[model samples]
Target: MYWWSAVGDYYWSYYRDACERSLLYLDVLRRRGEDYREQSAKAAPHVLSFDFVVLVDGRMLPRPVNYGLLRIIPPPEVETDPGKRPFIVFDPRAGHGPGIGGMKHDSEIGVALGAGHPCYFVGFLPQPVAGQTIEDVCRAEAYFVRFVADRHREADGKPALIGNCQAGWQILMMAAMEPELAGPILVAGTPLSYWAGVRGIYPMRYLGGLLGGGWLTWLMGDIGNGIFDGAWLISNFESNNPANTLWKKPYNVYANVDTEAKRFLDFEKWWGNPILLDAGEMRFIVDELFIGNRLAAAKIATHDGERIDLRKVKSPIIVFCSFGDDITPPQQALDWILDLYEDVDAIVANGQTIIYSLHQNIGHLGIFVSARVATKEHAEFVFNIDLVDVMPSGLYEIILTRADGAEANPQLISGDYIAKLEPRTLDDIRALGGNDAADERRFETAARVSEINRELYRAFLQPWVKALVDPAMAEFLRQLHPNRVMFRVFSDSNPLMAPVAKAAETIRGDRHPVEAVNPFLALEKMASTSIVVNLEIFAKAREAVTEAIFLDVYGSPLLQAVVGVGSSQPRAARASRGDIDLEAAHAQALADMTRGGFIEAGMRALLYVLASGGADERQFNALEALRNAVPEAARPPLSKIREIIRRQAELLRADETKAVAAIAEILPEDSGRRAEILSAIYRVVSGDGEPDAGEMEKFREISRLFLGKASPAELHDRQEA
Candidate 1:
């Protein structure tokens, strides 16, 4: 009797859920259609939660483009500090409309504003101004940066740049080209070394080769009447995970229609609104960057033939990537270092401080949008950015750990986690691994084939395609695309979907949700999981086949010759950026041995010894706290502090013994000031935990250098007692 009752209940719940879900799904589709209608009427649509005033309209620039620089208006409670460096956030325009960087209040812009920094945003309109090239866009962005900088002349430093996805590479190129214009830059999920990826993984890289390269890109632009619809790019993203795009997303909403609708609608507002790009812009992106992979190689040049070199960027760079980001893998994000510099020595020689943080598993979009990431990694970067800006030149990995509120100085760290940076070498980057020589040759062949195919298309098919497709036809075809059609057809504009809203309202007025423990609900979950697994398996298998075909076809020796990838020809290589003189640096450091007063000596001593205590957040907090304690006039500029730290680090690197002993010469002559410096060092180091043996040894040695008569041991022991 009980078994019969259970089965009856399951059947009843299943039937009711199916009916309610069908009605709700239709309503969602109706709402989505209305949203499309509403969004289409706007002049410049953005999903940014904050209001902004346009500072510079790219359309009005000498070389007009559709991009704009906006000054974000902070909320009433958020008082911005004009004295602090301004923050600028640029969202990716890979496909969808702009404003992703500030889409939410707890996002990149939000975090910067919350921290009292004046924030700005770089966004764009739906349609590009005619003949608007990528170069014009870059120039406009550069002007915007300069405009922001000029406004904040009283601020201590230049504005910090935060670039997401597509914007990452764009800003990187800008900074490299005009290095002086940009300050410290943070690029999240941005691809720099386009060709750098592990074989079998990152199948997206093989798309250009498999599709015969930039020819299709050209064809798309031509078909669009001199413009390219970004919908095509978004379709590629959706195709990457069919299960999620096709089934999982919709099913989740169906399962919990009550709460998921708002969230789904908000996301689709940005995702559904695909922007437009000029044919020239698309071609440049595909031929020069996507296929040519010339940015990291330093082969890209301005109209005046000035080279865009990554080494020229003098500001600190912080890269945030994730292992789970299949689209922009860590290899793509970080391998640019390897391509530009042969070793960590080369990076340091260029006077670059490149710090990267790797999250275990946040998807590509999650890097910019995930609330958890916004609270943790992004928060840390925002709060402790001063530490990064003035960090000594070297390669380092940024790591975050949960703050248990049990540390020596829990109050010091503002966020919930503590961020620490540890030194890394070239070998550390190499440990991620990449394609072998043979694989590289295959990619070279692909690039050559792409060039040939593009020329073939331009000569034979371009004129006819242009003749046939006018602006009206292009717009018609764009609306007919699978991505857009779904939004348009299911909308209230459709006569069939007209009754959905009314029906949905009636159902919702008397809806009864099924219990969680319902047998049918459990079955639904299992079925969803099974579908996801199958879809993943299919994606992997398909990717494997794609990889195999690309390897087999491109690796053919006959094709290699025809494509001009022969052994004797050789690939064009950029000049070595690692031309550095270690001996000269060491000598320079030695020459400047006794240059500064108490500030230099104190900063040097603390930096030299902090590593032993694990230079964590607390030490930095303590240092910042100390710096703040000093009157504004008395405090040395961060630039001056950074110069002293770099010189001292170089001296210590060249000769640790001599550098340690020279503290006596660099220290202020007054005995009272010497004691105060020692006290400050102890306070900074001891912020996190008890001093380790290595740290205490350095402390005692420094104590001896400061006070010769007091035995190092006696002083330390007495302080401990």
Candidate 2:
């Protein structure tokens, strides 16, 4: 009787606790559903933790759009300098609301504000105006940038633009269109060379191919009465990882239902708020980007016939991606360099400073919103953005190592990490791996097939779909979409879920919490894990089958011949500009060799010491620290300083020894002025860690040039005088 009673008691306890947990889980989900409904009702709502004021409303532009530019109001504790370059963040409009860049205290906006730069955000409303085109959006963004630039005329450079995901490519386009107006640009979690990806990884690249070239995209637009719902795109993202969407995420909340509610609701507020786009806009994106893959090759032209070229953008570019991001892998994020330039030499010739940083592990959203990334990568970028602007044209990798006992100038380091820009070659980017020639041929054929299918749908099927869908029918269909329906059913709008809230409240009042080591809870987690594994297996298998079909169908010789995109067909390469003449560039640099003085000599000598490879924030930080050595008013304007640095670095690249010898000529004849300059140069040079053999040798030779004729002093006066 004792043994039987003990077994009965265990069963009773398990049954009672499970019921309570179920009620609480339903309560949490109901709260999430309600939060989603409330957020969806707002217009142009952002999750920005900081306050902001609207500056330019794109809806009011001549070619109106749903976009708007807002100036971020920094908190009282943060001081912004008007003379510093302003930072404008463009959040991705890919099926979600704006403010991902400033969604938290530690984010891209926070990084810029902490560095004393003013911040602006370009966000959009939930619905696009009728007949709004992509060109209208682009044109409006360009105007916003110009307005920001014009207002900050006292600043040293053009506004630095930060584009996240979908906005990254748009930023690149605007930068190319008006190269003179953009400053340093950082594109995070963005994929530009859409056709470029490794097999078995980032299967999202094959989505257009699987759908047979976006015929369904046009069909959806037609069925929606000429408007496309962003919910479809959101569904695509969720489907990419079935394990996460189907089991892991929901189960985590169910298991920790009490503690996880707030975080889940906060994220869903942004994710659940879907936007609407014009059908024509959706068709354009599908054709020019998803299927056609023409942006990197400069094959995409504006309505007025101006080709969109990536090479025309003159500002420095920093690409931050991750190996763990399944959506926008490093291969997709960095392949545009391979698509645009033949080699690193071509990159340097074009006078582009391209820097990329790779994280070992981070998801797509984490790249923009994770506090760890904000404190590390974003902080380093803001801290060294000016150095990037003045850096010579070349490819580089940004490396951040922890600041610890072995650091040479730990005192000079601003944060916990020491950041450095190590020079990289095109081979380094290629090492990441991507599609080969055979894969390109297959993709080309697929593009051709897409064009054929798109035309077929337009000529045959579209009219029927458009005719069948009236305004009321379209609205009903949109409301019934799976993504929207899930929220509606669990929200207060549903009477069935109403009793769940009352039961949850009663359970909380008489809470009987289970032990952490409950057998039922353990079994529940095991089942959840098994379900997640099975779902992932299913997703991968589906991807594999889709990929196989795509390759076989498009790779056939007869199909290729019929499509006129066969192996014999020429692939699109970078458009030839032949604009960067290095010899002429060297000659131009030589003309300015005799034009500068003490400050120029110090910078040139520092560049030579750094010529062997590259320097980090050490030298820049050293200069800032020694700024008090001279009067603030006496410092040369930022523009003049950039010009001097560019010329000096160019001369050194063309003729190193000649450039070093000419440093003496640029220096003043006063022995005291020469010593003052030499002292300043050495102080900056020693800022970095102990020099290697080659660097030390160059430093010594440059020191010889500086002390050619010297006496004593402190920080020298500005050279422009």
Candidate 3:
């Protein structure tokens, strides 16, 4: 009888817990549905944490667009100075509404505000403007950037541009078109080379080929009444990880309904709010950028017949990508360098400074959305923007080192950091792409096939689809889309879920969570794991088969010939006419070596020493302090300082020994300034625990060239004492 009673109690508890969980899950879904409805009511819904005023509305432009420039008003707690450079952030319009870049306190806007910069955001409406095209959008964005620059004439320099995901490419287009208007630009999770990826790792690049190219996209747009719903794009992202989309996400909410509801609901608000793209815009994106992979090759031409060449972008570019971002893998992010330039020297010759940082394990959205990433990587990028601007033209890898002994926490840690801008090369980028020419050829074939399929569909099928579709039917179909259907079904309006709210409240009042050691809990865990494993297995199998078919079909020489793969050797490199004459430029720089005063010579030598790759935060601080110590009348502007540094770096690159000797010859043999420079160098190098042999050698060389015969160690020790 005791054993029977025990079994009864177990069953009762299990039934009660299950009912409670079910009610809570329904409540969560109800909240998500409400958020979705509320978001849908707004014309331009976004998740920005700060209030903003419209600076320039693209709706007012001659060729109107949905975009607008917003001046972000910081909260009272955050102070801003007009003297600081303004920041303009452009959020991606890929499938989702704007403001993911500024959705949280630790975000792109937050970091800029924290750094005391006046911030601006470029956001768009959910519906495209009537007759809007990608070219119109690009023009509107360029106008906004120009307005920002004109508004900040008193600031130290031009406004810094931060582009997230799709916006990254958009910003690049603007910068390439009007290079002089852009300042330092940061592009996070942006893919420039769509056809570049490693086999068995990046499967999304193969989807277009396997699906018979861009015809399906054209068909979908035609059926949607010339408006392509972004839900399809969002669904593609979800399909990339079925376990997360189909089971783990839902199960996570069900298992921890108490704590995870708010977070889940917030994310779902953005995920559920799908935007619409014009049919023309969608077709161009799918064909030219995705299927054709023409952007990296500079085959895309604007409406005005101007080619969009990335090398024409005069601003310093910072590319932030992650290894775990399957959507925009490192190859796609970095391989464009290989496509555009022959080597690092070519990049330097073009006078473009490109710096890239690769995160080890953040997903695509996390690159822009994760609070931890915003606080750390975003913060570092913000802090080092000035450094990047002053850096000489070349390829660099931005390395961040945590403060000594800080615990490894994913959340933001407010502290000092040591950043190293180490020089890299085209080979570094090629290594990421695995340097496979055959794969590129296959992608080229896919592009040709896509063009043919797109034309064929437009001629044979698109007209019929357009004729059958009307606005009413399109709206009905959109509402019933799988992405939207689930939300409606679980909503409170559904009579089936009517009892959930009251039952959830009762459960909340009398909660009884099962212990971790419970046999039933263990069984639940096993079931969840099994479901995830099975879904992952299925996803992998599908991807493998898709990749195989893509390769087999597109890799055939017959298909290649039919698609004109051997035609005219890919597009000519769209070399910018503004490309510098490196030899003449180097000669001019060498001549300028004798032009600056004691302060300029000292600063140049100090920069040369730091370039050896061992300088730390302490050193940078000391150098800044030294620069500040100069009288305002004598001190150079930040722009002038950057130019001086650039000239010196170019001279050093041309002839290091002569450049170092010239520094010693140009400066007056006044020991005071020399001692001050040496002291600052020593402080900078010692900040990273202590200078190593390489650093010591660089320092010694600087001392011999600038300060006659004094050992760097002696000078350092003397200064310390």
The Cα local distance difference test for each model comes to 0.85, 0.83, 0.82
Candidate 1: deviation at residue 136, Å? 2.1
Error of 1 at 437 (Å): 1.1
Q: Extract clashing residue pairs from model 2.
A: none
Q: Write the per-residue lDDT of candidate 1 for residues 1-721, one digit (tens) a residue.
A: 6999989988898879778987898798779888887888899888999988989988888989899999999999999999899999988989899988888888999999999899999999999898887777878888989999999998867889999999988888888778889778999999988787888788898999999989999999999999999999999998998889988999888888998999899998999889888988999999988888888788888888988888888889999998899899999899888878877777777788899999899999999998778977888899988878777889999888888888777988878888888889878988988866677778888888999999999999999999999999999998888877888888987899988998899989989788888888788899999999999899899999999999999989899888778755443455666457778887887877767778878877876776532357787788778778889989776666667777677667667777777777878889878876777788787777777888877777777778764544454454455
How far is each candidate from the true structure, as Cα RMSD in Å?
A: 2.4, 3.0, 3.2
- How would you order the candidates by lDDT, starting with the best? 1, 2, 3
Each model's total of backbone clashes = 0, 0, 1
TM-score of each: 0.95, 0.95, 0.93
lDDT of 3 by residue, 176-245 (tens): 8888887899999999989878888779999998888999999888788889999999999999999999
* Runs of candidate 1 exceeding 4 Å displacement: 1-9, 567-574, 578-586, 611-614, 654-658, 709-721
What is the lDDT for 271 in model 2? 87
Give a tens-digit lDDT track for model 2, residues 1-721. Answer: 6977866766667678778878898888788788888888776677899999999999889999999999999999999999899999999989888888998879999989999999999999888899988777888899999999989998977799999999998889888878888889999998888888888777888878878998988999998898899999899899888889988888887777777877887888888878888888898888888788888778887789888888888889999999999888998899989988989878877878899999999999899989999999998888788777777778999999888857776777877788888999999999999988778888888888888998999999988998899979988998988989998888889988979888899988997766676666677778888898899899989989878888888788888888886576554666785477878887887776666778778888878877755767787777766654678789676567777777677777777777778888878878767665666666676678555677667766765676643322222232212
Better of 2 and 3 by TM-score: 2
Q: In candidate 2, residue 594 scores what lDDT?
A: 66
Q: Superposing every Cα of model 2 onto the true structure, what RMSD results?
A: 3.0
Worst 10-residue stretch by lDDT in candidate 1?
A: 710-719
